[model samples]
Target: MAVPLLSVAAPAPHLIGDKAYDADSLRYWLAERQIKAVIPSTASRRTPYPLNRRIYRRRNVIERLFCRLKNWRRIATRYDRHASNYLARVALAATVAEWIK
Candidate 1:
């Protein structure tokens, strides 16, 4: 899913992801496209690359934002079947969350 999504989207200089995306193949693939992978290494890796903890800390902001959005029952659950409607609900939720912030 991530591979296909990255392929379709306009190339970004950097890609940030969680440990679940810490595969060597994925890192190599991103490197091939000149995308800097900011994913932390999994415990299984023999030798881990140096990761920028300061940059990785920024992921918390996004995580917290998603947490806030999920607090809305409509957005947390798939109440709206259509993708357009679902996206609108997400946008509305984000707008309301930002306003409240």
Candidate 2:
């Protein structure tokens, strides 16, 4: 599902994801695109791929940001009927989140 987005999305140096995305095929696919995968290897894998701990830690920040955004009842409930309105609300929420920080 995400592969289609990657195909059309602007090129990025890295692709960060969680354990759910830690598949050999996906890693190989990202390798072919020269995008470094920041996903950690699943525990069951025989040989775990080396991970950049620093980059992986950055995912936590994104997770926290989403948690904060979801705190807004309107954003969490998707009350906006239009995409533009929803985006505007998200932008407002993000600004408020940063301002409070």
Candidate 3:
């Protein structure tokens, strides 16, 4: 999704995935399409992978986002069986959460 989304845009995104996406294929794929990858290397990688230490430290924002989103009981339980309905609830929840913030 990231690849396709970035590919069709006027400017590409600088990818900032975690060490999980540090494989050769992922790096090569991003580089092949002119995307700047910021995935840090694992201890086992053959060489160090470059990363922006400042940006990487804020990775927990994703976790925090989910933690906030989960405060919506409907989303947490996934009571809406349909995908469309679920997405609507997610949007509604986001709007409400924004106001709360």
Which candidate gets the maximum TM-score versus the true structure? 1
Question: By TM-score, highest first, what's the ranking?
Answer: 1, 2, 3
- Stretches of model 2 off by over 4 angstroms after superposition: none
The reply for model 3, stretches above 4 Å from the true place, is: 1-11
The residue-by-residue lDDT of candidate 2 on 1-101, one tens digit each, is: 66887889998999989999998888888899999999998989999999999888989888888999999999999999999999999999989997896
lDDT of 1 by residue, 1-101 (tens): 78988899999877889999998888999999999998999899899977888888888988988999999999898799899999999999999997897
TM per candidate comes to 0.92, 0.86, 0.72
Give the candidate number with the greatest lDDT: 2
In model 2, the clashing pairs are none
What are the lDDT scores of the predictions, listed in order? 0.90, 0.91, 0.79
The candidate, 1 or 3, that scores higher on lDDT is 1
**TM-score (C-alpha) between model 3 and the true structure:** 0.72
> What is the model-wide C-alpha lDDT for candidate 1?
0.90
